[model samples]
Target: MKRPDTRAASVGVIDIGSNSVRLVVYQAMERSLVTVFNEKALCGLGREVQTTGLLAADAVDKALTALKRFRALCKVQKVGEVHAIATAACRDASNGPDFIAKAEKICGASIQILTGPEEARYSALGVISGIHKPDGIVGDLGGGSLELIDVRGHQVRSGVTLPLGSLALQDLAEKSLKKAQRIASEALTDLPQLLAGENRTFYAVGGTWRALARIHIIQSGYPLGVMHGYAIPAAEALAFVRRLRRLVAADMLADIEAIAEARRPLLAYAALVLEHVIRIARPTTVVFSTFGVREGLLYSKLPDTERAKDGLLCAAQDLNELLSRSAQHARELIDWTDRLFRVVHIRETEEERRLRHAACLLSDIGWRMHPDHRGEQTYGIVLNGNFGSISHEGRIFVALSVFFRYEGLRDETAPPPLTQQLSQAAIDRARVLGTAFRVAHLISAARPGVLPATHFRTQDRKLMLIFEHQMVDLVADRVGGRFKQLARLVGRSGSIVRS
Candidate 1:
């Protein structure tokens, strides 16, 4: 079967959950999920379901209005197809079918009301798609329920759904924190055995968990504000949750910019569930996942071959092609650097090799920026860019390398927390890569040809740059200086020879 052309298409997805309804339009590319447009309305359909066992008339009206608006937006954006999915609230409410019929008419798309188990499976798939080789239990806490599943890499094992969602628990516990904890504890009694293992990581999904993670990121002064791959030691996460559990509404809202005004009311309930899960699972760490049901649905549409492509490489290549001065020049840079690293007896771990490849592809992305600001601009882009299958450490390595490449060696712009996470060896490696890129860019001028004619070698503890005899005049003083700088970084004197 021919694989789907996900890269060439734009699609819209509508996620109707208990607490909110969201419409996201994505420009799906080979290795990246890029959100072009997104909007959400908090309709609290789940709260309505918990209260009266039926979708509320007011909530239905609000949701229908949102659906119509979403349909118009998708039309204006020229989205080829739209996928509308509803979870817990719509699936469990007595009047759900009636609402779905109306929603379909307004949105002009079939609304998929996922069963509990189906929802669990999709949530697990989302984790697999976003994380690299994820092996642990994934807990997706939505407004109406929580779904827990064991995932070994990309495979999803059996999962269970419980009525322990923040909004639902808030209603069940009658707004008491103690009651909410007790209810959460009771709901999770059977999950501990399911998660029993050594050094397992728990992947937390859903908006509420993301909100909690955002707060932690701000409070801890983490350099990377992105939450998709944020991780915390289990012990620390437990303590944080415990503190959140004891906080009153006023305290939850105090001086915390991470928590939005609308999400404040759900923090305590989110905390209760997180605390119990951490205590029961005893995971070595808790990792946050920004992709959940919506991402899962998109992943499900991909062909297996596309699904198997390295996400980091795909995203890197996409950005490189879009921003680089010459894509061929970037490829030449990769090959040129590979040969140099081999000649210098430098070794890279598999992960390091992948990061190096990505860095090379992205080396010239800042050429369009003002010359004075290129290095700093490139550093920020790599630091905050949407490249998946890369960890926090890897992000720092790539960003710092690019920063040094553009900005030269400077400590003035380095953030203490970011530097603290890197080892001396990692820092040294980044410097070497950065210096190497600086030399390559000068020699090729980020153009496409003659890279293969130049060679690098090490002899008598001196780094030698061998240029073809015909290209001798092409090597400028600035290029020679960068080459010597790279040589110095590797503890060697620099020499230039014409072969």
Candidate 2:
């Protein structure tokens, strides 16, 4: 007997952009797609397109070579399907069609050349797929063009694209920072998409913006280094980018190697574009997104039902299925906690409820680890997991709850530094949920069909855990003490009842 070849189920995307040629192979085409392989080559296909009006011969050769390598890598991975798309440089350069024709033959795949509007729409969809209930403008700056669109929730309004990408801007201004500023300002003047973005989020999507955000993260000493959903106040962001404009590329790279070497010189051009957009758009916050055209394209192909699923919960459910003692036990825990919260009058917002559900699914993931290290390990896993639709603050809350479940909610059981990102109210709530986990896990022993037989009730200012007759023997001193701790967190006494 032989094992099945599961690698054949993977899907891949090859993105031909102005500045970079990249390939990403995802685990599946489902709602919660995971990247199994990712690689990129900085080809600079649009480096001379702005001035020469043609793709540079060397740049074209570099892109085609990268594509050939990507195709072979996809074959080695046994990728079931591969979709190739080209943007900006390919569509604008006069020789772009000829280049695409050659590249297609080399990769053995038909390439879709996306127009500016199509690029804008896909970028907006990518933002919508990653951010929960996003209401903002999505601006994708590539090496040759910038796409701007307005999005609220799932709806994407009309969008506009401009020739303000870093490489293109540099070529247009002949490497003059002052001229780049003037060109960006002139190109973005009085755009309605930007006008509609006042006081809302400006979702920055592109490699350059991600590199810029990485710099911000390294400098701020932020606990979580995840780039997706990193946010900054518009005023503060303006000040930072303005400071960059005054410095040379060497100064910008001083003591900072977090950004790519190829991307360093373009930083000022990117900053200039951002500065002008912020000034005109008057957005309140700038959010950086790792998801962009590729993610958006995948999202566009999904059915509405799949698109409606909660990404965080979906990802968590996958983890629970893979690692839990019993996936059914996790589901029962969700319901049991639901009853407990209601009985104890623990109010939760809709978002908080979802976070709690995800935490329950992930609570037992560290059971396979050593007892001494389970808390720390699980905390780090959830804190840095490749999850979306949850903010950094929400991540801290969920992680802390699971941490308390293993480590025990005692004063001496100090939490990690990331907990500081959450509010005091949220921390208290996590402690309460974690204490509930402590009691529940003990009663059921990580098995299903035990929690449903038990329920919670309140009388005379005392929270009571009532167990059926068959489960009476499972109760003990430790259970009572843990229940008491949970009750105390909510300002109530604790008791256990057998019925």
Candidate 3:
């Protein structure tokens, strides 16, 4: 196994799935995978694989064409290495080996045909890479097969592959929904542990599942459009799946503008499969994971030390380094805020602390945007950013905090839908964190210099900001006013002193 080139300018991965062939170019960062370019061609390689046991001729042609273009794309993007992996369709198809040979020639890279368990393990690793402390069963439903693996933290348990994928089941059951459901349930019956992941999370992978999640997000008017950590209660998810199962093609196309027209055909089968899984597994939540086999391949190449880093923090740091005025200042902000929060006696749980750290690292990402649009831009960026390891609520908290930091406390432009999902306590804490950031920025101006030495202390039931005598010139009415606002939110009167 070749170690990932940490200094590689870019790395490309082509995922040849049952239904689609995608080429993703990622700027391989120190601790994060940032997508630079991604395009998918729906080749439907598994369209007739269940019955014919061979890759469709037209599908193979399309995939080959796509591969040629993707190879060119890698060259144009200056990608140092390109990894190509073919999943269920290629593994199950009789002509798969021939296709792989031709694909290797076209793409100028060897195509690795992943076995069922290998696919399951990679999908699980994808979940582990994107989620913090994931302890549940990961289900990756592709067009040809479904891969289920139990994952706890970074460890992967034995997984099973079922012939119950949407496309395969559609053909297996002759497009009968009831028969598909029965087949899925029966296929999963032997895996009692997988079916009995009660109250745990069921992480959904694969393009079909992501499309279903997108439909749900649009139908429900979800504020955040990102799907990496989109989670819904098991009951609501099951209900939504059931509703999707009953929806006609016209209705589905009309209701979900997020789903592409080509994907609409598989919606019902996807829903039917999901509904059966939900009924048996009874997970407390259904989480949509954007990471899958492709991401897992990248993750697997990383050194163990790099892989052990926190996913959310890695993303935050990457963003800071890429976009902020000074990544060092962001690190300083984290440390400075740590002292501020401790001095203010702000109680933060471990999760809250991690979110706060991420927010601090991301605080200055919007500096280059126009002043008027910075707040809105930051809000959208943080909310929809490719961050992993944080829940939807954590995303909301971080986005809102950064939004307030740039937009000020009195701005009425906050999106209500997102804010409403957060608790009052969470909202207040975010406000405090944001206000702290605002004050910090005012004093430091997002520069790489040392911040004015200051200490926060409680005196006579009031918040006192004591500045060093040498740093008194850095304090101003604007800085004091922001501090006072944070003080108010924390239910304390505020005063500033140069000592």
Candidate 2: list runs displaced more than 4 Å.
1-8, 249-255
Model 3 Cα lDDT, one tens digit per residue, 1-499: 9988666578889999998999998887445788889999989898888888999999999999999899988988898788889998899999999999999999888888999989999999889999988999899999899998999999999898888777888878887777787887778765765765788999999888999898888888887788898999999999998888778433646545667776777888888888888888889999999988888888888899999999899999988988999999899888888988887788989899999999999999999999998888898899888768899899999988998888887756655347998999999888888888998888888886555377778977798888888778988898888888888987899988888
Question: lDDT at 292 for candidate 3?
Answer: 81
Error in Å for residue 248 of model 2: 3.0
Candidates' C-alpha lDDT: 0.84, 0.91, 0.86
Each candidate's TM vs. the true structure? 0.93, 0.97, 0.93
- Candidate 2 residue 438 Cα shift, in angstroms, is 1.2
lDDT of 2 by residue, 1-499 (tens): 9988654378899999999999999888878778889999999999999899999889888998898899889989888899999999999999999999999999899999999999999999988888888899999999999999999999999999999999999999999988888899889989999999999999999999888888778767776888888998999899988877777555747556687788888999999999999999999999998888998999899899999988889889988988999999999999999999999888999999999999999989999999999999999999888867777888889999999999986678777778878889998999899989999999999999999999899997999999999999998999998899899998899998999
Model 3's number of clashes is: 0
Report how far off residue 390 is in candidate 2 (Å). Answer: 1.2
Against the true structure, candidate 1 has what lDDT?
0.84
TM-score of 3: 0.93
Candidate 1: tens digits of C-alpha lDDT, residues 1-499 = 9988655778889999988899998885334687899999988788757767897788889999998899999989988788999999998899999999999989888999999999999998888888878889889999999999888887888899888888888877878888887888888866653456237999999888999898888778887887888999999999997887666455745656666666678888998898888888889999999878888888878889988877777778888899999998988888998998898888898889989988998899999999988877788898788656778888889888887788776557554247668999999999999989888888878888868789987889899999998778777778778888899888889988878
